[model samples]
Target: MIRSGVLQITLREESATTRIPARPDCLLGAGRQSNAIDRGDVDRTLRRWGASFRTSLVFAARRSLGHIGSQHIGYDDTERSLGMSRTYRVELGDVARARDALSAVRDLAAVAQARIESLATTHDPARSHPSTDTRVDAAMNAHDLIRATPALAREQGDERIVVAVVDTGVALGHPELRRKLLAGYDTVDLGLGKVGGMELVGDSRGADFTPRDDVGHGSHVAGVVAAQGFRLSPGMAGRSLCLPVRVLAAARPSGSRRTIGVGALSDIDCGIKVACDLGAKVINMSFGTSEAHIDAGAPPPHREVVDYAVARGVVLVAAMGNSGQAEKLFPAAIDPVIAVAAVDERFEVSSFSTRGKHVTLAAPGERILSLDRHGYRLSTGTSHAAPFVAGVAALLCARARRRGVELGTREVRDILVRSAQARPADGHRDDIGHGVLDADAALRTLDADLSASPHGRTHTHG
Candidate 1:
């Protein structure tokens, strides 16, 4: 018989003792009764009694605390900011007992709340990255193909590579995405939950490392890196792996340019740290400020951070900027990065893509189809060109890893430039870079190392 306001408890006679699941609602709280037992509480109780039940209760405290949709709790331990607190992991016996334990510690706030979500196996280091063959096509422009995949899988696109795109942010729900995605961070100066400024004061409670795209720029750049490569052309089917890292934000809803410049350096630094920590082999930076020496004749602090990441085996690919002048952009102008210029479908230099000595290569940037807010749209700028090289670098890393040869940023840079199919330019125009990206030719050179083996094939180009 079921009692009113109480849950229906059905007992199943099994081979062993009759163990009951925990029911937090069965216990009274604030001199009142809960409508039903909390499933998480019951699961926790059963597990305490050594029941063989598998479930996930791991959600970062900061992400779950303020959200009422989930039954989450937070723990307090002033001793460490990030490590787990023992006070939250005590045994509560049966379902009834678990409720009692929770009620007792609920007042403590931190003891019975949520936990941080762990990174998944797909994103873990041991887990191999996805395939890239589905991204490349034979008809891809020679330059587009070179910078569009990693050197490792230049021939077939089966290699695992990681390409980081630093921009406004991405729409995680994009159709062409979801699978190849690793979590990203928000560096937009949207102060705490306020309208503008950085979130200087971070989450007060637990660790929530979920990445979100504050603006659409990162998503767009990511699309260029790993969007369904089939979108590029028939020949460029599958060959790119995109990693989204947010380093900028839309200052206003209008999308018109506004200066929220103070945190740019900090945002970029944080992004570089996260990308490196996540083991991204290649980073695509598509944003920059033209005024190199912003004030007091000093360069931004992120310059050093970029150098550090590059020194640590990170290949930095950046946009030469769209200022349409010989003026150089920091980070991009840094020697460690492969600076890119933009080209159109007809292979002409974009009027806006920045040029100068820093330019390393160019790729199709004008009218490039990439992911955006609503869905996919055509965007123009040198920003789109950088990822082509970033993807190509990923292929190179894969090839190098297979050969048991580790590559530093400098070596990677040299290989890319040497492999490039130089565009017919009137010498390096401050805007067009060394030339447009040549994926087919670049792949051929990287594959030259493994020509003796059966893994890579030999092919000559025009």
Candidate 2:
């Protein structure tokens, strides 16, 4: 449930008793996500006990949740970021009952920050950052941004580096993404089954059973990361084995295609774990929402989600966001995840790219053309920018693995930031981080690092 939100209280324990170990103290909310409560058990144990407290309200709440299809809760055994706790979602009629339940739930500890009302709005740490005009685009062009010709000349592709795109599901038929796919999962089915309270419209093939991309966003982003680019920039194509982990639902109807929809935190958490388990060396996150900075002391919702991926040696990359404002958003604002901002053809920071110190690098994002369902099409937003960086990271990872050089997140991020062509603006660096993304330049940096290290491999860090 949104109320007790800290990466879902996942407790790992198998007790002999029929009762579960970790559970919420109260039940006054609409949804809860826990691995511990199965539908059969919840209907038998929780609903039965809940009815006794407030027969009418409990019955009504269950019925309402059922109508919205909340019964299709999600489960992921691979996610261990928060304490191992089974996910559960249920509605409770009374706060008093919540208190009483908390008192008796000896195995679980309730934290004040988990309340839903208190966490409704979120904040971006760098939104208020003062604007600064800069010449970073020139810096990237001087170093060859997006032109992967040189990198490919050295090595055709890195089969070992798995790059995962955890966004809306991807359209596998897109010619640009044919070889880029590894089997992916659909997390939208794990959600409340509604977008902004409206019943979902896309997924005619039933994405719940097989992941499919009704929205083209995921496929477009995947193009930037690893599209063969047969019809687009073929020489600049990325060849990392792409993993599409669909988290958002395809809700908006746009003729033959559906548009991206809002995603719940549970979907993202599940996607991150699946990506890591599937051997994703690089993961791209292209979605985010603004949060109120007033709650600075409160932990942001997705902090632990980002941390979990980083802890597992996954090189996480996130979009700086398309808000066109300075304040930074989640995942991108998180320290370990490399935040990428967008730049245009002229190498100027995109007007829509989010600006902030948290951004690690800049990439071509303004109306840049990439793969689409029918052919190549023009698209914009930090969504495209982040994948460019992800593609470069995967390319470098591929080359490193071939040379017997194992690299970690810190080593890869350092290479991109340090090798970037400096974009000095008015005597200081602007919000676009170090500069524009240069695929060839980053690979050269990786090669140099390997040569300098012992036995032709970069130093590893846990």
Candidate 3:
């Protein structure tokens, strides 16, 4: 993950530094680009601009090249790489020089960013193949566990659970999520742009960005977690509130032809931080880098950040990924994260959902109902399966809070796993994790906890 907080590049120091005063534009759009950042290209970029000119903004300098384009430069973020990176609009003694520097900085920075992004995708396996099949909604195990319709409706549906969808931006005005959105943040934009600007920046298509569902991925996942009004059948009708965080904007059409991979590690890390910072108890992550083999030591870089979030008492759920093999996806693959694998209506694992030792839970990923700008659509993917767990996690959180229990990630996991209906393949299979999540079973577990407590005081665990 990119870590939390903003990385501001200032042109001037406090006292003697000349301020170029310009808004920093995200060349890659509103979120992290899933593509790889080419190391060879970055090397070539630095070499092309040989001879160290006045790079420090704390001191005065002149604009060397006014081709008026920006360059994307990556520093080691270490002692050696510090203060060497050049940015746009330093106090080149005047505005023209500042403008030229700013332009140059933007241009070159774009090039460098492209290179770095290429490297970013190299480590992941999810982006290896391109697909045109839209996401489908899978059935929930609620039917088998609930038994009765009215009771299920009364006990399960009305419980308002807040799920934070940390991915590309959500369509805030979408009828399903608009009502339930308790709070939201752009994280990448710092909430600076106007309502329309939000979409424009998030779409990553320049000034003409629209918040509509360009790619149905985020909306599909969000709808599963907390769509406002839904009807799976006769008695299945309910909705949950969704908090949309636009981490990945639209990709540049020419740059990425197939999929738009914007949500970067930094964007994801920042999104999680924002969700935690906003007091969101449940976080849903449908996207991941690559899948690792089982028995691997610790998790990758992105997984570590997720662990930190889980430590803070937030329930994090992620997609097992769509590789159709026994591999572990980051964030989902992490021990703390509830990795969700997708199963179809037949109760068979989806061909796209990855399987491995880290698979902790399973959900219906085929023909699942969700909302999009076009209307309700049947979607499929482990991505959709994750939000189902997130919704269940929120319900659990609500029950815990109602009973006055200070729950952490571990305690939450314990309750959920214990409540689940043990399956035949749970103990050893690399496919389904435990089994498909049972909402009614989870609720019953909370009921048991509340009954055991003294005067409604729940227990705590680390």
Candidate 4:
């Protein structure tokens, strides 16, 4: 079985920096695209490297969260192809440990852009894997966001919309989430036996894999997004279909004593594409890579995928990191996607919630209750905060469908922003964008848009 610890290389036709014929990897970086930035020779070169690294999912972000977009939300991209002489695992169980290769391939256009394909863990220890004791329901009832809108209070059904939980994995047996989950793909096992996006943007698209959640983070995040209200009891949200895509894999090499949860931005990119292809209207990302950590101008692995989703009419929402500092996070920091921060019942931003221009708005990330394997429980983090926005976005989609009007990502984002209860702060209200997410306000905004139409087309509910 081809495994991890592989060295991925990239070369260019004309580079003043490199010496040709580096390591004798056959024909590497033979030609360049007309754009020059996008190379075709490298695409073929990657295919020859080995089954495309599964390119599916390498696992990195989140202590449990996913990037580091279910990026276990912070998949660390860049530096994946920096060093060339590393080991290259071939598909037929062949290993090519190339060394002393700098002189073999002179056409190395750019060497700095390439690095190891393996994802390095990027979890913030100060605020990851938050688990609070069984909190009282009264704690939830006091949340102003609970009363801020009709998220839970809205008596209705909007099960047609699909929300992809691009996180670790989701509990399939959970009573509340079991029925709502759509068939999701796991990038860990997905393969690129055939050529796909990997040739273009270096993404692994075609493959077969299973979506399974080992850590409870992805499941909890799903619950907040759309955990289906149960008959025996009720829960926070679940008005949309929950599509679970497992992108995070074990920390150790495959077939070892699996111990850690890892995620890759590439995996997140693949998951986002899978969700989009499967028709997910809203992609909920509960993990992120802090901008404070990455080098300037470094390409964000999930940025293209996130933008693609939005262009396809998918609303992307991600947790601003838990650093409580002004910085950018993957998917969330991408601008088009909604960046959610955390706030408490008093509407006070959580101490650990990230604050900066990237934040779209605040949600109840502190000790919020949602579905788990054992029933409802409380969990904290911006990881928990993002799904709430996703759920409300789903609600708006459902409402749009009823009104016979279509809602795009921007429309959804604008509705949320305009309907939000504004607060006072420095520079556009500091971290919390607009204000706390109010489900009812969003609903009202949707209705207002529908009513103001020139045609004044009207529709009704069941």
Candidate topping TM-score: 2
Rank order by lDDT, top first?
Answer: 2, 4, 3, 1
Task: State each model's CA lDDT, in order.
Answer: 0.48, 0.57, 0.50, 0.55
- Candidate 3: residue 149 Cα off by (Å): 5.7
Candidate 4: tens digits of C-alpha lDDT, residues 1-462 = 112333333333242112121111111122111111223443344444432321112222212122112222222222122222211212212134221121222234453343333342224224334344545552354235544335456534377788888876777788777678888877643233311111111122323355666556777777767655452223233457788887754333344332233454445555676677677888887766555444343355465466556556777888887777777677688867788887777788888877777677888777666765456666677787787788778877877877675566677777888777655454245578778887777777777778787243322211
**lDDT score, candidate 2:** 0.57
Cα miss at 260, model 1 (Å)? 11
Where is model 3 more than 4 Å wrong at Cα? 1-161, 187-202, 205-213, 230-240, 251-261, 291-299, 425-428, 453-458
Give the clash count for each candidate. 48, 29, 48, 44
Model 2 C-alpha lDDT per residue in residues 365-422, reported as the tens digit of each score: 7555565545555566788788878877777777877877666677778888877764
Better of 2 and 3 by TM-score: 2
Candidate 4's displacement at residue 424, Å, is: 2.6
Ranking by TM-score: 2, 4, 3, 1
Lowest lDDT 10-residue stretch of candidate 1: 117-126
TM-score of 3: 0.63
What lDDT tens digits, residue by residue, belong to model 1 across residues 181-234?
Answer: 776654332223322222222321112333455445566667766666445421
